[model samples]
Target chain A: MWQEPRYQKETVRENPVEEVKKITFRPATDIYEMPDGFKLLLEMPSVDRETLKVYIKDNQLHIEGEKKKDVSDGKFLLQEIRDVAYERVFELGDDIDADSISARYEQGILEITLKKKEKEPVKEIKIQ
Target chain B: MYRPFPPFGSEFMKEFQQFREQLNELLKNVASGDVHLASDVMYPAVDVIEQDQQYVYVVELPGVKKEDVKLMVKDNSLVLEGERKEPEMGQDVQKIRGEIAYGKFQRTLPLPENADLDKIRAEYKNGVLLVHIDKKEETKPRLIDVQVQ
Candidate 1:
């Protein structure tokens, strides 16, 4: 079995203001390892682009977004779809280039690509 | 992705397609450990809302196009069918974490007695599919007024 890379485990965080509690669901995501970097596909339907935030802080990848309410006037008969906010956290490793992270959200899917850092070669010391 | 009781009714319990849906959903509940098993069966989450003259059914289908979804009304039931095409996998790509339920899924619900199948309409937006089912005028509730004698 191929072991997942070190940058896989994620931890959710709370907003700076700790007033009323907000529900945060871990967005269902797919992570794939490419020859050059890693790609993450997340499901976040009904989320607006302006409300989405993706950034890296303290070597942790943070993703947070707000979903707009589309049908607020009607009474819900079957409420399987809850219009809740979403958040995700991922710890980044030295191999990852935090500056190169690129993301795109379309049709409710957010795709993020993280490029890996080039490995450095070790040099041997010469004795005179 | 597991929720509280699914609330699936007896209508779903009686059909072979229901069995497939259950298996697909069960695999999704255990998808973190068994991704391959979860393929081909994802109960796309949905919500059905009631309006004055129509019933609206909404389903979240991220990464799916309108052409990939099919809506049908028959035998007093409404059926939703769709497929999420597998992402193109280059020869060098390797899966590290697979959690999104991919592939085909089907859901059927008993239509209201007042449903007018002829006027059903569907629209896709931001990964959400909305199907508006206009209720027959006879089936819609109307308030009656009586003049005081």
Candidate 2:
């Protein structure tokens, strides 16, 4: 029980070092395919909307942010968990138009909308 | 002092109504998650045992690295503090949903009088922290035998 706090401290101190390493975060995401686009829902706790960064990179979508600590100074009767920085990535499909992707964060959830690319016209074929 | 219609009875009643509304608002704030407390954190299961001349404590902290944890026996209390860092995100992150919990946390437990101050050893393996404490020699119980006719 006591070591839980130590775990939290080390995580905070080593965050800068982790940035250079390859790490994977398991974030629950829901994807919905519609006629016009795809909708994605992401959950992130203790993260401020302004601190989150979402973008597409090399056919993959990336989400990263730093969650600020909620602990106050000069007092503590008990503590068990701490909020830390997080980053997540997702692969985009070929049909998705990268240029038309949009995202919104509200109530600790991130919702992303990706429009599908328009299909090219097909010419009629005649057989002799 | 029995005058002025009970000191503006209607006015006093209006103020009392407003006070009740404010009290309800305060209760709402207290019930919300916005209030942060140590109890709000997820606590790993733990068990402590005392046998013969030693005290043993086992803490289960799955999905947490040993290096990220800190254990300290201070004064008459055992303080445990650590943070569970969120894993890095991959290149493609469409959306995020359902965050259970990831962050810094601390828990402190008071030690009993019979607890040994010295001869303490701690080991962490398989996401469990085991601390062995040897009680003071003077505190150990002595077996006594009596022969009856």
Candidate 3:
């Protein structure tokens, strides 16, 4: 004998909500390969240290921040700069040591350094 | 066909009008040419905002030092000049990629009629320069009460 479990098939509905879309721009970057590591420089104007975020996830480097407008209430005589967030990402090579990465932010420029991992030496096997 | 030229409508007047139009076209081309030349150098982004008491000018100059920038007010125009030097790296370092613009930049913005040039103040922070110019006292809006008869 087989018994069927009683259950109610209720449809789940999601409420519609309005969302604000934010504009994002990619900051200009310069990459250099140093003797022992790699250095990356990003130019992100008006982005302060407190708002900037730099991290590595899944072997990819991510940098993002928002440029806040200090004066919000004003009539624009000439508007050229836009209120937007800056984001950029780069893929990391396997030779890079993720644990030894370091960064510094100054003068609206972010500098990140990624060190290379130590290579394993080759073992010479003697004739048996 | 040649007839006696009327004093009011003559060929000289038509020639003058044509000359004026040509002069206007030439001036427009020259103005646009100047903008094209300016673009050859670095043109930093700028924003001018007007407030009740003052006008603010914001200029973005990243990777530039404060000492390298110069601001001056001359002939009812604000002149901004700066240079962005490339960072020095080690001799063994190799460039993988470069996208940043580095060079001398000059930008001039005309001041508004109501701006008080003498009261201009500037500040620089985080590679952004802010210039505040107070508005003329008499030019500001004022509320006047009308006397009832």
Candidate 1 chain B worst ten-residue window by lDDT: B29-38
Tens digit of per-residue lDDT, candidate 3, span B30-144: 4322111222256788999999999999998878999999999989999999899889996999987776778899999999999998999998887789999999988457889
Q: Candidate 2 chain B: worst 10 consecutive residues by lDDT?
A: B31-40
- Give the backbone clash total of model 1: 0
Tens digits of per-residue lDDT, candidate 2, B6-118, equal 47678899998999998786665333322123232556545566566666666655445667889898878888888765544344543233233457778777776767777
Query: Would you list the rank order by DockQ, best first?
Result: 1, 3, 2
Residue A23 alpha-carbon offset, candidate 2, angstroms: 9.1
Candidates 1 and 2, the one with greater lDDT = 1
True-vs-predicted CA distance for residue B69, candidate 2, Å: 33
Residue-wise lDDT of candidate 1 within B38-75, one digit each (tens)? 35567888888889889998888888878888988768
After the best TM-score superposition of candidate 2, give how far the Cα of residue A121 lies from its true spot, in angstroms.
2.3
State the DockQ, from 0 to 1, for candidate 1.
0.49
> Least lDDT summed over 10 consecutive residues: which range in candidate 1 chain A?
A1-10
Worst 10 residues of 3 chain B by lDDT: B31-40
Displacement of residue B39 (Cα, Å) in model 2 is 23
lDDT of 2 by residue, A3-57 (tens): 0111121122235644533222333455655677777665454454566898987
Q: lDDT for every model? A: 0.78, 0.59, 0.78
DockQ values per model: 0.49, 0.06, 0.29
- Look at candidate 3 and tell me the lDDT of residue B140: 50
